[model samples]
Each structure stands twice: as C-alpha cells, then as structure tokens.
Target: MIDVEETYIENRVMVQPNHANNLQTAHGGHVLKWMDEVGAMSAMRFAGNSCVTARINQVDFERPIQVGDTSLIKSYVYRAGRTSVRVRLQVYRENLRNGKQQKATESYFVYVAIDDDREPTTVPELGVSSDRGERLRDEALAGEGQ
Candidate 1:
C-alpha cells in the first residue's frame, strides 16, 4: 500500500512579474502550471516512480492574486489504481501586505506512473491512515462527484 504520509505534498511560489499577465493579477496559465506541478509531485510521491499527466479534470479560478502574493499549492493522492494516481490540488494566495489569504484555484489531476521505457507502471494502493488524510480523500472524492 502507498504510504499515506508520502502521498501528500506542497509547493509554494511567489507571483512574480513573469507569472502575471498584462493585468497584474496572477495569470490563469501560471496558476494551472503550478497546480500541475504540485499535483504531479503528489502523484510521483505516491507512485514512487515518474509520472505523466493523464488528465486535468478541471481548474476553477475563484479569486485573483496580484503580484507580491505568495501562491501555496497543496496536493495529495486520494485514490490510486494499478497505474494511475488521482491527485487533488488547492492553490491559495497569501497577501502579505494585508495578511489576507484566499483560495485562488483548485483542480484535480490524474497521473499515470511510467517506467523507463515509458510504459505504464504499477503503483501501490493508497491507504487512508489519518483523520486529515481521510478527510482530504473524502473531499476529493466528493469533488469528483463520487
């Protein structure tokens, strides 16, 4: 079984000039990029092998994060198959100036572990071991309309 603790991952990035569009707000593409990166990290952590995106179900941008804000991406593997890991990611924006924070975007991504030859590889089964993990898994599954 997959180590539940190992399946959770987080990454943080600052919204720099390059990550913004002409509007000064965090660009949708950049947010999606970070979500994909963090989701992949969670998948790889759960699979213990390299993984590639099989699908990005959807990305919902709820709020705008301007420059100077820090984007924190949290991801966890909530389900797994023989070769696929389903990851849920949440992106939040921390505004240092006002000490405010909000969820900027969220997405669910599916990844398939691959071997060196680029063939699908098996991954360990996921285990829900803690209240937080179980809760997150429940949330993700519910978000998937399960």
Candidate 2:
C-alpha cells in the first residue's frame, strides 16, 4: 500500500506577464496546466510508474490569480484502482509579503499508469496511515462534485 502522504506534491509558480491574460490575471489554461502536471506527479508517485492524465474529473476556478502573485499548488493521490489513481488538486493565490492566500482553483484528476509499451499497468493500492490523511481522503471524496 502506498501511504497517502507519500504521494503528496506541492509546487509554487510566480505568475508573470507572460502567464497573464488580457485582464492581467493568470490565464486559465496555465493554471489548468499546472494542476495537471502536479496531479500527474502525485499519481506517478503513488503508482511507482509513469502515469498519464486519463481524465480531468472537474476543475473549479474559485478566484482569479493576478500577475505577480504566487500560485501555490498542492496535489495528492486520494484513491487508486488497479490501473488508475485519483488525485485531488488545489491552487491558492498567495501574497508573498503578508503571507495570505485565497483558493484560486480546485480540481480532481485521474491518471493511468503506463508500462514500457505505453499500455495501462496495475498500480499499487493506497492507504492512509494518519488521521489527517484519512480525513483528507474522505473530504476529497465527499466534495461538491465528488
């Protein structure tokens, strides 16, 4: 069994002019790309193999992240099947100076482990070893969109 915490991944990206849209806010495409990358990393960590994005279960942009702000992304594998791993991803717009943050986006992604031939491969089971990890898993499963 793969521990939930072991599959966790966190990344930070400082929004720049190139990443912004016409409104000077971070482009939705860039944000989604970041989420996908982090989610894939988490899934691969849990599967112990290369994993590819099989599905974007859902993505909700709660707030816009402006240019010059930092985007903090956190991802973790909360569930796993024989060949698939489900990851929960969250992005926050953080104020570097004051250390305040707001939820900018949240989503769930599914990834499939792939073998050398690029065919689907079995992935290890996931198990939560801590109360916090269990709570996180349950909360992710019982979300607004599941």
Candidate 3:
C-alpha cells in the first residue's frame, strides 16, 4: 500500500506574459497543463510506474491568477484501483507581497499505470495513514459532491 501523503506534490509557477491571455491573467490552458503535470507526478509516485492520463473530471476556474502573481498547484493521490489512480488537484492564486492565496481552480484526474510496453499495470492500494493524508482525503471526498 502507498500512503496518500507519499503521493502528495506541490508546485509553483510565476504567471508570465507568455502564459497569460488577453486579460493579463493566466490562461485556462496553461493552468490545466500545470495541473495535469502535477497530477501525473502524484499518480506516478503512488503507482511507481509511468502513468498516463485517462480522464479529467470537471474543471472549474473559480478565479484568475494575474500575470505577475504566483500559481500554487497541489495534487495528491486520494484513491486507486487495480490499475488506475485518482488524483485531486487544486490551484491557487497567491500574492507574493501579501502572502495571501485564493482558490483559482480544481479538478479530479484519473491516471493509469503503464509498463514498458505501455500496457496498463496494477497499482498498489492507497492508504491514509497520517493525519495530513486523512485530512486531504476527506477534503477531496467532501468536494466530490460539488
């Protein structure tokens, strides 16, 4: 079994002009790319094999991260099946000066572990062994209804 915390991944990116849309905010596509990358990392960490994105659930962009702001992405494997892993990803817009953050977007991603031949392979079970892991799982579950 793999502890949920062991699969947790966090990443930060400064939204630059190239990543921004006409509104001077991070483009939705750019945010999605970051989320997918982080989610894949979490899934691979848990599966211990190369993982491929299978599906992406509803993605809601709550707010925009300005071009000069920071995008904080957090992802963790909350559930796993025989050959699939479920990752919860949340993006936040952070103000560097004030050190404040607000939810920018969130989505659930499903990844399938693959072998050298690119065939699906079984993955270990997911366990919430620590307080942080349990809390993260609970939060992900709570958001499922929305």
Best by lDDT: 3
Worst 10 residues of 3 by lDDT: 137-146
lDDT of 3 by residue, 1-146 (tens): 89999998999999999999999999999999999999999999999999999999999899999999999999999989999999999999999999999999999999999999999999998988889899999999888667
TM-score, cand. 1: 0.94
Question: Is 1 or 3 the stronger prediction by TM-score?
Answer: 3
lDDT of 2 by residue, 22-119 (tens): 99999999999999999899998899899999888667788999999999999999989989999999999998989999999898889999999999
Q: What are the clashing pairs of model 1?
A: none
Predictions in order: lDDT: 0.87, 0.91, 0.95
> For this target, which candidate reaches the highest TM-score against the unseen true structure?
3
RMSD of each: 1.4, 1.0, 0.8
Candidate 2 local Cα displacement, residue 79, angstroms:
0.4
TM-score of every prediction relative to native? 0.94, 0.97, 0.97
Sort the predicted structures by TM-score, highest score first: 3, 2, 1
Worst 10 residues of 1 by lDDT: 1-10
**Cα miss at 32, model 3 (Å)?**
0.3
